[model samples]
Target: MNPARAPQSVPARLAQIALYGVAAAAVAGLVALIVSAVLNGSLTRSGTADALGWGALILGFLSGAVAYSQSGQSRIESTMRARLGEGYRAPGLPWPQILAPLIGAGILSAIVFALN
Candidate 1:
């Protein structure tokens, strides 16, 4: 039962991942609103939705990429440590966390399309 093998506590992990998704969504939504306003010279419902959806999708994909890169980095570090006979422990990839933003993006996109 290596500590590194065990994933983080469920509730804590969920909260952290959820926060990340929500923050990303909010930031993306704001950016989209600004861009829509600038391009259209005013705010429109469809425009807002489209902008938010695009923002969320782009940021979500970026977040997933970053998570993947981090996972790869961890694995590499672990391998290096093992080869060096060091006692460094690398955390396992948190798949649920990594997928959270992507899931949020999909849901947001669906809602946007439905509205439009």
Candidate 2:
């Protein structure tokens, strides 16, 4: 049995693709939000608003990514456990680590948008 040629299971491949898709969605959503803010003039010419908007966009994306990652991991773990007839525990992302930064960025972006 060649380790390199080991057959990959469909469920594992699907789980991996789902994780990647979630990450791509998060990044795309962030970019879209930032672009929309800029186009709507919600960000000012001083660059401060732009920075704030970007910050918020990134924070929100991170938050969402962490959440989705954990959810996907849980689903994968559950499916694997069920198939293998064993208990599984998947580690979740550290959401608290990004919460404060996200809240601050959100507030800053709101203020900037309000002033614009």
Candidate 3:
């Protein structure tokens, strides 16, 4: 095995991908809802609900992914470096460093999108 590549079980990789998928879906759904609301001039209630829903969903997913990734013997940093290449850091609190900003940015974007 390559030194740069860490050995991971198939199930683990699948789970990671699934987590990403869920996050993406949550973000996408929120965007769709916001767009619909904007088009229909219902931004007040619908936008707030969509933003809150997306934020909660994203936070939950981040927490779960961090927990799951950190459950094994290997630390998240090492796994991320191996999988994502060098300079990878797990996100703060409950996220794998690298994913923290991405997740935050996505949620923020959703909020802005809804507001606009």
Index of the highest-lDDT prediction: 1
Distance from true location, Cα of 18 in model 3, Å: 0.8
TM-score of each: 0.65, 0.48, 0.34
Relative to the unseen true structure, what is the C-alpha lDDT of residue 11 in candidate 2, on a scale of 0 to 100? 78
Total colliding residue pairs, candidate 2? 0
- For 1-116, candidate 2 gives per-residue lDDT tens digits of 99989987987665555555454444543564577667776744555555556656676777677788788888988898889999777766654543544554556566568757
Check candidate 3 and list the clashing pairs.
Answer: 89-97, 90-96, 90-97, 91-96, 91-97
Give model 2's TM-score versus the native structure. Answer: 0.48
| Model 1 lDDT tens row, 9-113 | 889887877777776667777887898899999987888787878887786777679787988899889889999999877886667666666656765677687
Q: After superposing candidate 3, which stretches have Cα over 4 Å from the reference? A: 1-4, 43-116
Provide the lowest-lDDT 10-residue window in model 2.
Answer: 20-29
Error of 3 at 105 (Å): 22
- Whole-structure CA lDDT of model 3: 0.59
lDDT of 2: 0.62
